[model samples]
Target: MNFSTELIFALATILLIPIYYYFTKLRRIEKFFENFPNPPTVPILGNARDFRSGPAFFKSIHEYTRKYGNMVHIKIGPIGHVLLASDYKFLEFLLSHNKLLTKSINLKFLEPWIGTGLVTANGGPKWKTHRRLITPAFHFKILEQFVDIFESAGNILIQKLSKESGEKSVDIYPYVTRCTLDVICETAMGTKVDVQNSETSLYFHSVKEMCRIFLARTTSILKRYDSIFRFTKDYEIQKKSVEVLHGYTKSVINSKRKELEETRKEGNYSDVDDLGRKKKKVFLDLILEATVDGQSLSDEEIREEVDTFMFGGHDTTATATSFILYCLGQNKDVQDKVLEEQEQIFGGEKCPKVTYTNLQEMKYLENVIKEGLRLYSPVPLFGRRIDQDVEYDGKIIPNGVGVIVFSHGIHMNPEYYPNPEKFDPSRFDNVEGKQPFAFIPFSAGPRNCIGQKYAMLEIKCLLSKIVRNFELSPAFPRHEMILAPETVLKSLNGVKIGIKSR
Candidate 1:
């Protein structure tokens, strides 16, 4: 009996020993930050134990900023974090001097889906080559052509709203997302999206799944059992959906190629869009002409660039525009002010007919858009990987750690604006020489969003059309949905709002 008991005890000890060793291996990274500005951490998991939301995360960071200064450090589950820009000195130092310090490496998962497109993949020849090639495609001339796309989409949308007139407040989320997707499809690929078709909605489903997978991969607890969970069922499905998206795009390229080939045989292939120019019509057309400092995009590279455009172009704008309209609903005075601005610009009776000239003339409407961006910047935290090791505020932040810049934190900092919480566009008016890098809704530096001009034009055009068709106000409690999440932006809740056509 004694012999048998001893053998069983030995087996138990053997199993427990490996478990202890495995845990230690997992936590090997925690001890190096003994002197840094570490936030209160719990054992075994560190700060993950206490990371709550509903303003708690932002408020905790604000406390850390007060206690440890703006350049403090914290561990987000074995990952080191720098601060959101709370002061000009450190902000300039991190952004300007330490260009190498800021990058987007932890966004590793997105590379497969987004494929080293501007937002996801970082440094090396890949980004530089793609950026150089794709940059000019968004030049002002190309951007201007998209205005009609936005206008026509807006007109169609207002027609739908006119149908919804006098009904109880309706949720605008689906409508807004559909409209943005329609516009992006037209502008980026020149396809007439049959949005009523289920196949067309597959892109949105894949995008939503990818966002979920990103959240899963980033959290530390989920990272454990990584070997077993590496290929999640949902992840596999998402990957398959991406394959579908690629196949669809390949078909587009093949069709275009077939046309060119046939034209070559019979001899007439270079006529342009209806404007009498001698280039092909949409983003794909321009990209075919782009050269990366004299290197043209490869066929596969063109596919990747188009995928990037679809990923970047659609969802974020839909969320932002929906929330902006939601905010307009929530604040009567602000809405009235915007209405007055629209009246001055478009003449009150004809707000739906906003020409490019009138869009430029709507200054106060511009400020309203600016304030909405400030209040709810589409992407809350954009991750960048270090290009090289660099110094910042007397510390050596070694290269390869993720640089997670919280745009939301920077946007809401009270120090930069006198009253950051208040929605005031006049802050922009009075602050001329404030700073070039302060308000980065689309981010800054050479790698900022390529579609800022196109995005602004679309948003302004759509909002002008919306204001004409609907006097928006919340059906739910006013403040209930000032912030809700639909991937990158804080989409509004209830989405429930009244509509009245002019």
Candidate 2:
């Protein structure tokens, strides 16, 4: 062959490889979804167009579920096939079982910010080890100790809002976010970022920017490709955000280590309380003391886990608490009931702080929180990569495809939650009879949120304090509130409410 012909043939062969693979993969996906009910997919792009508006995509999925039933498969582009399962039984099986333990590929977007921490780590021995080592940090006893921190933070929030009390209206999300940030930083890293007051702190800005970038990446089709995304401004912002975040975490870790060393050198390795039990350690301290396979976690590993908790612990809880406040603002009846419940606990006491015992007696308030989470889940969707082929309702879901467990859909399912749109906390009165996976605000099964109990305690503490100090009125009517899905469910226009001192 001529030299030019030879070169042309080599290039043709190289191009044909991907083309052939693409067709074969497309055919396989078609065959796989042939038996399943799926929304109409266009050639090559599949359902990519459906997600052009990233935040609106969840609403689209909800509409699709309503039209097409619960277990609907979707394809995004040539390679991606997603199964969005909102069926209660399907979720119970998927989340509770060990076979499908790995997180979905979509979580890869968070690795740049959180790394392979518990939130994004894949299933296997490494994840198992991490889970075991970190679980102790959230033990009931440890969480009980955190109540003081929650109270302190809640007090700060109340004091901050006191200035705005009886003002026309305020967007409460930023205040709640700052308060949660303070609580999580103090609890997780044993350091205080004081983000509630220091609004422009590098740590606070880094976390906010990181979450914004993470959500933006998850919603953008073009941004999913690292080669293209890295050159963009979002990617650069993400990198800088990570730098600030890691720098902060590293400093906290070093400071704690130094403190530990000083204690050890002074022959005061442990301290005991009056009850004779060793003093509880913070999350970072426990992780530092942990040994996986007989070796301690490296600084990067510890930082990843700390960052994961900081992100998970604060953001989701803040979103949930904000929405809970919004729900109360809109539903005066519900708000009245919650305040009545709080009054019953405090009994006209002046400036009563939320004790651990106080949190337990607030059953009515707890139910309200649950109902609010049901309507607006903090983490709306749980995505998993199916590790093995699984059969559900006698249909086979092929292995290697992604499964998105839509918590919002499940929460809104009329069958599970009657009058789903109404803010009725009574549904939780007999929650024991509900389906196992029906109310998964913190998710379900083995990978369920470890900090869930802590989150609940924190929310109750803050909400109790807020309701006691202010009469919350909706800035906009119930129907006017618009929600957008980001790292967590957020108000597109901010959660605005008018607070009058009680």
Candidate 3:
């Protein structure tokens, strides 16, 4: 045979083997899936066609749920069986299971950017040790120190918003994103990138691009494989983003390491800033000082944790805060209640420096934030790999399958929250009787978000400042954000709102 024919034969052989194995595996698992409802699938392509784009995948999942039951089985070609579940009982079982801690392959897309950080790391000894060491960094006392940073960033946000405060509709997402970026940089690295003041932020832009690329690559089956993805334009963008993101993080790590070495040798290490004021220990500082089994973490390990926090901290909180503001704009009565609660705490002070005690006192505002999180979870979907056969509702979910917890579906389920569409803060007023996994904006159980408390505090602080100083209204009085399920929840049409000085 000629060389060209030989090459074609070799490639076909390589592809055919996997195809054959997947078909065989499908036959073995198809029996379990037979008991579950799923959308109609093509013979070999299965539902793979529906996942060519992120929006399509998101829309199809919802459509399938509406047509099928809450738990919909799907076959996506070689990716294998997936059970999209929003049932709270199944969710509680899946999330709380000690053995079901391995994340699915879908999240493997993030490893290039974050590199097996806590979020993407499987349930193993390293995850357990890292979790143990990092948990202390988010202690309530430590989180209290970041409140000043939150207030400082919130002040910058309010000033920027003041410039845009008028009859004109303003897209608050970018402003909120910058504020959260600034806050994360200062609190996570003890470095100020000043994202809010800069007309453009490279780190901010790179993070956004990375998230966009992840969503795209995740939904496209071909793009999920590095060999194929490397040939695409999205891969080029993703590679550039990683370079920018990792370069910035590595430089910060080197600088902090050098500073620690010098200060410790001099016996003059001080957690005090200029003006003789004590400085708060950042997440980087904690990681730097941490030692596991009598050996400190390497630079790469440190970078992984810092990048994870930086990625986790900014965008998710910013999205939540923006949606909370959007929720407030949509419901004037709820905003009025939030304002009344804020008045009782700050005594009608306009954008006062928020305190931890003050935050604790704003009980009603806390419920508003909780209600906002329920309505628009920043992370709408996350999943775990089924390592072994598990029985739920007397049906077996076979091994080698992935189960994606549809958080948005759970939040919108009327069984969990009556009239789930309404923006009712009172629903959170008494969550004592609520199902544990029913309202998981931060997720639930062991692998839940470690920085959740910190996130909540920061959102509360920022929202309090904005609501205190401004009267918000929907941009069109009937304005509704077009929810787009990306790496983080987004509004395609923009989180537009009208703001006026209160």
Top TM-score prediction, candidate number: 2
Per-residue C-alpha lDDT of model 2 across residues 1-502, encoded as one tens digit per residue = 9999999999999999988976755455556676668788799988878876645787789888998988888888877778888988888888988867988787888898788989898888778999988887788778877888888888889889989887578889899999999999989987878888885789888988988878777877789899989999988888888989888899999988898789889887656866888675789998998886797888889999999998898889999999999889988999998888888888875368667888989999999999999999998887888767777778766666678889999899999887899999998898775586988888889999988998999998899889988999978343355777788888787888888889
User: 39-150 in candidate 1: lDDT tens per residue?
Assistant: 7766555565545542455456656766675545566654444433445564455555524523654466666676766776555578877877777888877776777788
Looking at model 2, which ten-residue stretch has the lowest summed lDDT? 476-485
- Model 1: CA > 4 A from native: 1-36, 52-69, 78-85, 97-102, 196-200, 223-226, 260-280, 349-353, 477-479, 482-486, 491-494
Worst 10 residues of 3 by lDDT: 21-30
Clashing pairs in 3: none
Candidate 2 regions exceeding 4 Å error are 1-16, 19-26, 41-44, 273-280, 476-479
When sorted by TM-score, best at the front, the candidate numbers are 2, 3, 1
TM-score of candidate 2 on Cα atoms, chains taken together: 0.93
Model 2 clash pairs are none
TM-score of candidate 3 versus the correct structure, residues matched by position: 0.92
Q: What's the CA error at residue 174 for candidate 3, in Å?
A: 1.0
The number of clashing residue pairs in each candidate reads: 5, 0, 0
